[model samples]
Target: MKHEFHWSQYLDTNHQKFLSDFKEFLSIPSISTLPEHKEDIRRAAHWLSNKLSTCGLENVEILETDGHPVVYADWVHANNAPTVLLYGHYDVQPVDPIDTWDTPPFEPALKNGYIYARGANDMKGNVLLLIHACESYLETTGKLPVNVKFLIEGEEELMSPSLPKWLEENRGRLTCDFIANADAGQTDKRFPTIVTAVKGALGVTIDVITGPSDLHSGLAGGIVHNALHIMSELISSFHDKDTKISITGFYDDVLEPTKEERELCAQVPFNHDENIKRMFGVRDLIHEDNYTPAEVTWFRPNLAVHGLWGGFQGSGFKTIIPCEAHAKLSIRLVANQDPSDIFDKLERHIHEHIPTGVKVTVSEFGVGAKAYTLSESHPALRAADEALKSEMKAAPVHVRMGAAIPILATFKAILGVDVVTMGFGNGGNIHAPNEHQNLAMCYLGARTYARFFELLGTDGPVDH
Candidate 1:
């Protein structure tokens, strides 16, 4: 119970600088989804590279991919201890509906024990915590407890479109025992959560052309096929009344969850059905027949129409049959589901349903990834478990996220190491407006990171 946290002194001395740097880091609108923010993305990468250098990390380089850059840094002086590839993203999701935010999304605001900013939780804060945790050890003890290599990329918000090829191209330099992904988080402030399982994702867009141009509904309503209706029908065909994906072979590769695994999912603190209702302000939660809320979230696949657009805007009453319609869809996959296979099946289904007068086209909407689950006994997972228990005063909850990290599969398949996620984040508005991070939780995350390194190497969860 009486351990000297050597990092505590460094943390106390540099508290003000930490806040100042965090705000500056969050201020860059590195919205990866927007072309206009490319410069900001590069700015974020450079800023992070410099910050890593300042943290005593060696060989800091802004490694360029075909898309955005990946900032790499390392401190490999732990002498045969385990090496952890710490993964993070410098990019934040685009703050859509910007008018809904109380303050500007990029301008970080510290109020009510939270830091309100675009990347506050979904991960600029997570990246900074890793740097500070490493710095605390380097500054106080002149070395990290374990070797660490940072792989902070600039395109996670786009589901890491460039990471697969980029990771394969640089696998030799990134050889490690495991990955420490700062892209995930705890279920609540009361306890820590280890994301042992994460769902895969496949994104696609539907484009329908039913006519040459817009025509009056009175003239074209019966004669012409409506593009909007065509697009809607195309998406609607992916599901039946139960909302289960009805695509051919959609469930073919899905790995079923074990009885024990489902039980553990049921034990998690965050209730999926309840939170879905509360978070989205929806009155009813949809179900997939023979599954609990937790089971559906952790084990099953889902299809969702995330974005849709067609004719008729200003002040309504524009009675016209639009010539074109478009929609964006997101499909979440569980174990053993291949993104490519799912993508192929989805494309085939769309074409099969195309009406005689209409032409339908579909393209990959964004990035794709296969589902991933870490081994229960991975050393890095154990270290994270111990460190979280030491900090949170409770055993960490093991949970599966229905969302995709997109790059986790690439890490395992290409780099041959399972990524052990040790992020301090959550599901509350990660890609929505008014995004915020609990400053206290961020500090706790930093402390836990230091201890995890200690447990992974020569230190005893603290310094003398």
Candidate 2:
């Protein structure tokens, strides 16, 4: 099971071309959150399918999902070798606050050795690395060392609403020994890391309507209750003075962090003051006693209000009481917590707090993902650690992520396999304005993934 190979040297010479191709891939405005970009999402899927076919992957096709389509491809010729599924998403986050960006979010720009784009850091750059790594192996050796399958989706940013059923229906087509996820990032730009745990998510929209239509404040100021006032009260009711969730049973299923897990979360390198100033652009942050910012972010559950709207805005004052108020609320869940249960309790609590003369409605936005953890002793993780050491000359760091990736737990439940979420992108500016990732990191990631493919295929402990 051998062929001529020099992936690292090839990367050394062809990195500029790789960056150019990646820029082309990132140019598509495949914002899944916006319905207007459906064509763009389809274009991105076709583009990826073409790239995979060019790489000589068999069965390359665009499989339809209820929402945006999924791109699937594979090479399964390796006899008795471990099969690996490479997962990523082509759709990107909506570029809201577009005025804050120095350049257009969809337009790729190279500056300071980093590529500025919407999906550059959060995912698309890493996706390109996976594709090119597999392509490199096939191009150089004319065959892959293992059976590889790609299951890139188009709706991860939307909590992957259509993927669970798709996975269940196509389980036989996508069976694999383990999954390699390119969505998570490294501890920092300098060291490799593997994400062992991730927080789950529950999203809901709160709507309040107190009147039939907007009424003049002069006529309704004292007679009618303002919907915005009621909405503010409802939002405030979600938290107590101590800032913990006030809903009953919200914390019932939460698993408190163990001492060893807390220690691992602390091992991630971050300067508190610098991160506060540079990464978050805030003067200070709040946390309970005995927990660092990283611990609070990666280990604890928290609620946030993402969007609030219900009034008039036309560069001047409109003397009318808005009849309706709305807010977008989300909660991050820790291990053992169920998003459905939390939503049920939250909805009940909101109804309990509704004041007289006002009607409230709460509805979940997405299906929600569950929190998950992988043991350090997993052979797939050990193989990834060795790959990082071999390529970057440094041991990998194990850390938990604060983001919600619903598919991780689904993969474990459905396929009975754990995903190795090794990091490669820059940590700063994900899901924010001026999002960017280091091109050098992408190159290193390509080399590391190439080596990882070989490790998973030959003399690797993943088969056990």
Local distance difference test values of all predictions, in order:
0.85, 0.85
* Highest-TM-score candidate: 2
Query: How well does each candidate superpose onto the true structure, as a TM-score?
Result: 0.95, 0.96
Q: Please provide, for model 2 over 195-237, each residue's C-alpha lDDT reduced to its tens digit, 9 standing for 90 to 100.
A: 8888899999999999789999998897888888888888999
Among residues 3 or more apart in sequence or in different chains, the pairs in candidate 2 whose N, CA or C atoms overlap within 3 Å are: none
Q: Considering every candidate listed, which one attains the maximal lDDT? A: 2
Candidate 2 residue spans exceeding 4 A from truth: 1-5, 271-277, 460-464
- Encode model 1's per-residue lDDT on 1-464: one tens digit a residue: 22245886677667677788899999999999889999999999889989999878999999989899999999998886888889999998989899999889988988887888899889988899999999998887788878899999988878888888888899889988878898887767676888888889988988888877899999888888888888888878889998789999999988777889877877776766786577667898887898886688889999999988998977958999999999988899888888889999999888899988788888996667889988777656777888999988888877788888888988888988788877887435688898888877877888888888888895322110
- Which regions of candidate 1 are displaced past 4 Å? 1-5, 272-282, 459-464
